[model samples]
Target: MNLNQLKYFLAIVKTGSFSNAADDMYISQSSMSKQIKALETELGVDLFKREHSKVYLTEIGAEFAKYAEMTIKQHNDMLLYLDEFATKKSNTIRFGSIPVVSSYGISAQIAQFTTNYKPDVNVVIDMHETNQQEVMKELFDGAIDIALIRTDYLDEVDVFDCIPYKKDIFVLVCNQNHPLSTKEAVSLNDLIKYPLSLLDTSSVIYTIVMKAFERHGIEKKTKCLTTRHKILMEILQTAPNISLLPLSLVDLTLFPHLCTVPLVEELTSDVALIKLKKRRLNKITKDFWIYWQKYFQMQ
Candidate 1:
């Protein structure tokens, strides 16, 4: 049952001599002899029969020897396995932030984090299609480890440390060939007549755009086309539809034909690095925060 008992049995088997086994273990020959005696008594079996100074394993001893060697190997293997797993668990930092940060080549800065101890950390990017308020809510509820969301949204939600990452400009998008695209400066009234197909009602953009319409009392049948990026682009390019989306989604390389005229309005979101007020962050989390600061501050 005890490890010491099994260890002594194995040592004697390997050395084939009690004196040599005692020397290998750096213990007295008498201590080694006592351990073997204790094991033999507990198992109720004669482990070795000495004949003319030649030590040989008895039939029962040989059978128990197999179990003893296996037990000792398993004990050592378990310690090695735990050491490896502990390193992995410690290096794994469960953090999640929105694409609002990851989309802007912030991943490059995140990729630069290096630790002398672990050196590698796994940062989980949680880019969901929910509103900024909802994203912050998740961070508050411990659903997400960390979140990159508009700071304004967190005003109502109960939260903690918020590092101001950067500021993002709100851009109005329309088809390159659409009528509004040619205008010098389109007003909110100009977009009212056209059936507006903006971001989904669940998106952060939707919340901001709805507030403007409500403030102005602009009455129109706004089409909330909650579709994928590809589908939304198709609808915007083909029909007289206007929408406001994150500037990051506009890939000039892919959608060069799309026309983007600034809204000429004071509509901007303060992107922030946010985490819960109560939960404690580990070393990996701290390292990521450091990378984030450099990422937003750099050229």
Candidate 2:
């Protein structure tokens, strides 16, 4: 019925007597007999037949003995499996990032780390990209071990410890034939005149752009708000609507019709590696954080 009871039953079968089994198991004979009695009561069958001075398994007890040994073996195997799973999980670093990691060469930086660092053992790095807000959320919730995110929201969260990596400039993106596309630089005033294609409210750029406009007492017009870069590009290529995007995300070759115009105000945001201050990291994640900290300082 239970592992301990099963173990006791098998011990008696192996030693051929309850008294000898109790001695091998370091339990009193009465306790061992009581356990076997309880197991037999639960199963509604006698497991042992007693002769003058020896014990033998009943027909039903021999069959149950095989299952009892198998159950113990399976329980031990499960324990081993869980232990191995925990070890592998600890060895893997769950890294979260904003969508522009590849655009800004951060992915290359990570690749360099994996190749150059001489860890005692091979460490697995699992990384994924999401919007900035979600990256921050996952880091705080312990869903991710570390994150690459914009510093826009970092200042507001007191619990974060971050290493500043690089500054990315914001630019105006529009189709080549759009009115502002020919301008060398555009201003907030020049931008508000045309309908804007803004990122979803969850994005760091949206938060910063909206704040910048509100601070300047400008009410901007919106053509569409989206979370997908492809959708934003499609809208930009077909319409006069313009979007403010990080310089790293603007690939002129990929979208030949889209051209980037510098912002006259020179708005910029810092990208950084961040982790929750109170969260205790495993050895691999801790080494990753420390390595990047020193790496950024040298840069």
Candidate 3:
């Protein structure tokens, strides 16, 4: 019925579980179910069949899926074509960033570049804030000219040239009332006894945290899994559950009730400014990239 419903349908098909699809789409499971139900009602057909723990497509759902995928692809291609057309007509630099851009002072750097370095240049910085997956997707689709993303896709090193700006380390986050808050540092073994609220399984941080626990032979009792940091933090405060999050995302000033503790094992991800290596940049985008390169060297 709607684009979002179509996206949710595909997410359910890809993940094979309602909860997993909700995590992938960064929405509540109930909302996902309701939307899918609405979509089914509109079409007058069931799209999924559930057997115990897994979800499978119905016969008609398989046929609809092919059309749904084609529709989404066409929608994306249309946006990309529009972006390319707009780029030719205007002095705009389509800059994409993940949610935690402020944590790395990326916005401040951009401000300095525009205001201090090239105040006379009539360039518009069109900023897009999204998750890591979409950031990479838009960058590849040529919808966005440059992006600040995590170094999760190591295989794409040769495809894009990037400058590392921040080394984001993992830390334990909990409310002041938590038992672990008093500790300077905690180990993976220490976390086993407590209820844990972690990032979604689809997230890069979640994979790293799980691997750390596995490597240390620790079994984590994950009580909740979500992509929203605010929800994750609120859950920590409402219950005794704790979370492992990036050091930059743990803001003590914003959440005075919360405290962060270092992990005994080191887990880190680099936040970088990246652009396609072979793509020809417009004057504005080219200048912005060159300015950032010089800015990093000066640092």
Candidate 4:
């Protein structure tokens, strides 16, 4: 019913006991019990079922937990705003960028944000390893105010506004010693001739590269190597392996020995900035977006 009640319920569910929840929340067990009781009374249903001295959320309890989580997140964000920027002149915004986008000028944009809009706005950039779908989860859950992600990977959240960040490219990379490495570009013939070391095709890079390969009529041929991320530099560092990777994966610092050239064919990927529909983007997110645009222009 209230933020306190939701907090109590979540704590109980997490700690699995009233006494433990009270300890975690630093409240008296009786007070914790009263809050739970009041919540259960208001809902007119049992939220937790105790069995063998263990407590678990009942069917409705499980469902209400979701609502409680959303409510608590909203309340907490409000509290943060009140304490940090009571007058609302300057506000802090939190946002996220997948590692790939961060390399593509997202961080630089955020850094330069205050150069133009001085005072009252703080931007916090959180690095997350989420793909497009998980990016939606982070945004919708209010964990991040906005996000920079790959466009092709956007989840089914139709309400969010997506701004084009840049025209990024995905390329196939391998050791220079690789047989196909000497070729100016890859072809189905070139790919078929070699065993492929690849990242999980379900990953963002794979999806982007594979879709292009499919359109070009290249059959998917993979060899033994597989990884979640870092497939590019990993394969390159090792010998006789091939991987699909974003062009930026060849950063001099990250992959000191890596050399990048365009693949035989054109494979394009886009970076995008997205936010929840009709949501008020706090100063932080907006500043990041504005600077991101400028960064892209300079590039």
Top model by TM-score, which number?
A: 3
Per-structure clash totals for the candidates: 0, 0, 0, 3
> Where in model 4 is the C-alpha error above 4 Å?
1-90, 119-129, 213-231, 252-257, 293-299
TM-score for each of the candidates? 0.61, 0.67, 0.69, 0.63
TM-score of candidate 1 to 2 decimals? 0.61
Off by over 4 Å in 2: 1-85
Arrange candidates, best TM-score first.
3, 2, 4, 1
Candidate 2 residue-wise lDDT, 1-299, digit = tens: 78879878887897799898886566899999899999989999989999976889999999999999777766654643453458776567789988877777877878887787676667688889988766765664356878988887665467778898788898999999998888888899997678889889878888888888888899876779998666788789989888988887787777899998998887888888888776666766788898888888898
Better of 3 and 4 by TM-score: 3
Q: What's the TM for model 2?
A: 0.67
- Higher-lDDT candidate of 1 and 4: 4
- Candidate 4, 1-299: lDDT as tens digits: 77778888997987799988887677899999898999899989999998876899999999999988777767756754553555342355556666664566655655566555656444344556565555655665466777877777655658777778777666666666666655667654466665566555445666766676688777866665454446447656666666666676556466655555566666777778877765555555566666666665786
- Which candidate, 2 or 4, has the higher lDDT? 2
Against the reference, the lDDT scores of all candidates come to: 0.65, 0.81, 0.82, 0.67
User: What's model 2's lDDT at 134?
Assistant: 65
Of the two candidates 1 and 2, the one with more favorable TM-score, higher being better, is 2
Better of 2 and 3 by TM-score: 3
